[model samples]
Target: MWNKIEMKRWHRLFYDQLVRRWKQNIVFAAATIFFLQFLIVKLHPSEVQEFNEAQCADIYPKLKQGLISVNEGMRTLVGHELKLIGEKEFDVTGYTVKRPLLNCLDQEDELLHRTIKEKYFVKGNVSGRGFSKPYEELKHPYQTQDLLELVFKELRNGFYVEAGAWDSEQMSVSLLFEVGFNWTGILIEANPWDHQLGLLRNRNALYLNTCLGLTVRPQFSDFVFTPAVEVKEGQWMASMGGLSETLLNPDSIKLQCFPFYSILMAAGNPTVNLLILDIEGAEFAVLKTIPWNKVDIQVMTIETDLIGKAGISGGSQEEAREFIISKGYTLFKHRNNINPVTGLENNDLFIRNDIVKKWNIKFPEPLN
Candidate 1:
C-alpha cells in the first residue's frame, strides 16, 4: 500500500508534469497592447466585432509573472499556468509565456477595494436582501451581468472560472466579480494569448489561450481565428476569435484541449462560486469532462445550442442538460435570447440545489 507521503510525492510529480515554467513581465504585455491598438486602427479588422471596442484595464500594471508563481498543486495550476498536457502535438510558437503572452494573473485586492469605496457606494451588505447599488456600474452583453447580480446579489470575494474568455474586457462575465468584488477566476481562450495580451494583462485571474474538451486524455480541437487582419506592414485589424468541431475555415488552427477537471484540479478545486461556459458549441462535450461529485460550484451559466444538432454522434443538448441536472443543479433560469453577462445565446442559469437550500434561493422552473 502507498503511504501518505508517497501519495503526496506522486501528486507533486503529476502537477509538475502537467504544467510548465515561464517568465514574462507586464511591461512587455503593455507595449504589445499599445502596438496592437495602433495596428487595430491601421489594419482592416474583421466585421464580426463591434467598432470602437473599449480596452480591458489591468489591476496591477507592474505585477510580474514570477510574483504569481505556479505553486504546483491542484488549485495552483491557473492564471500564470498555461501549458499543453499529455503530448505537444501542436505548435506552441506563440504559446511561449512572457508577460501575458498567453497566461496572465492580475491581482488587485487593495486597489479594487479603494476603487469600490471611492467610486461606487453600496447601501446594504452583499448577502442581505433588497440590495441596491445604483453606483455599481458593470456590464456584459445579453443581460448576463444583470443575471449574476440578481443571482449572487453583490456576493464578494468569490471564485469564477470561464471558458472562451476572449478580449478580456468587452463581454467578460467574470470581470465584474474580479474588479468589483475582488473575486479570483480562470480565463480560458483558444485564441493566441498574445493577440489580446494588451487587454488581458491586468485581469485578477489567470488568462489562458486554450480550449476545453471532454476527453480525459490529451486531445486537439480545430478552431477558427484570424490572429489579425494585417492589410500592410505594422497595420493590423483586431483579432477575430472562434472555436468549432468542424474545420470550416481553411485557415483554421488546431488547439490542444484539456479536460475541465484538469483545470479545476490544478486550482485546488476550490469551491467555485460561478462557472461560465461559452466555448462555442462544445458546451456539452466540455461539461461532460467534469466529475460533478468531486467538484463544488455554487452557480453555473452555460451556452447550449451547438453540437449534437447534426453531428455524426447525434448528441443532443437535452442529454447534456439531463446529465447536469442529474448531478445536483436545479434549472432555475433559462433564456433563449443573449445573456447580457456572457454575451452568448441559448443560455441556461442553474443553481446547485445545495446552494439553493443554503442560500435560500427561490427561483422559477426551467423554460422550455
Candidate 2:
C-alpha cells in the first residue's frame, strides 16, 4: 500500500510538470505564429488577403448569405409593423411656445407672489400661469416676470437644491438668479472640462468636482461620458456611466466616494423645496440614499428612459409614478413634445402633494 501511494504521488508530480511544459510550448507556438504572420503581412500585404481567400473562401459566401437572409426576415417581420404604426412626428422649434397663464384675482405684484407660491409647491401648468419665454430670453424685460412666476408657482426661493448643474446655459440657473431665490446650493459635477465651463456660467454657484454616493467612505469612483446623438451643441449633457462599463482602459479612470448628506450639509441645509436630479442613472443611487424626512424637498424632476446604458433597470414609468406618489409627489406635465418617431411630448414634471393641496389644483389620474 505504501509503495502504491508513493507511485500515485510521483504520477501527480509528473502530470503537473507535463501540463506546465505543455502550456509553455503552446504559448511559445502561438507567439511564434503571430510573429511569422506579422512579418509576412509586413513583407507582402497582398498575400494576407490571398491567404484568407484560400483558407475561408469556401465557407465565407455561404455564411454571408445566411446572415443577410436572417436580417431580411427580421426586417420584414418587425420593421414593417413599426412602419405601419404611423405615429405623428413633429419638430421641437424651440423651448418657448404657447403655454397656459395663471388666472388669479389680485394686483400684479400680489398675483406674482401668489402665482410663485402656488407653482412653487404645486405641479401643473405652472409655466402657463405666467408667460411664454424662451430659454435664451434670460435677460429679457419679462425675465423678472417669468422668474416671479416660477418662484411663486414651482420654486421655493430659499429652500431648493439642484444637482448636476452642467453649465450656466441651463434654464434653472437663469430663473434662480433672475428671481433672486435665496439659494444656498452645491453644484456637483465630475467632468473637469465641463466644471470649468460651469464655473464661468454659474459664477455665483458653489461648484464641486466630485460624484455623490450613499456614503462618505473614502474610495475611488468612475465616470464615463457618452455623447448625445440627436441633440446639437449639448454633447456635455450626454448620459454618464461607470468607467467599467464605458472606458476602454478601466485602470486609467479614477473614482471618489462622497456621502449624499455631506453635500446637503455643504449646501447649508436650507429647507429643500425643489430637488432637480438629472444625474443620468446615478439618480437611482442618490435618491435611494436621501434622508427624505430631513430634506423636505417638495418637487423633483427626473429623466426616465428604457434605453439607459447605465446598469440601472426595473423602474418602469408606472413604477416611477408610484414611487413618486409614495414620496408624496404627483406627475404634473410632460414637456418638449419633439418625439423623434411620432414627435409628441417627451419630458415630464412631478410636483409635491402639499403644493397641489395648498393651491387647490387638480390633475387627472395619470395614464398607466
Q: Tell me the TM-score of each prediction against the true structure.
A: 0.56, 0.49
Instruction: Estimate, for each residue in 1-368, the C-alpha lDDT of model 2 and write its tens digit.
Output: 01111322354565467567767799865764564354333322221111133433443354344432211211100000001011332221101000011111111223323323332211212123221234345332222232235434444434445565544333343344424544445555654434444454433345565555533222234454442212223322223333222322321233333445555554445665556655554555556566667666655655443223243433444455566677777676432322242122233456677876775545434332
Q: What is the lDDT of residue 173 in candidate 1?
A: 73
Candidate 2 segments exceeding 4 Å error: 1-151, 154-156, 171-184, 214-219, 227-252, 306-309, 337-346, 362-368
- Minimum summed lDDT over a 10-residue window in model 1 is located at 72-81
Best model number under lDDT: 1
Residue-by-residue lDDT tens digits, candidate 1, 210-297: 5665465334455554322222345433223455554344435445455676666655568998888865457787676677877888
RMSD, candidate 2, Å = 27.9
lDDT for position 292 in model 1: 80
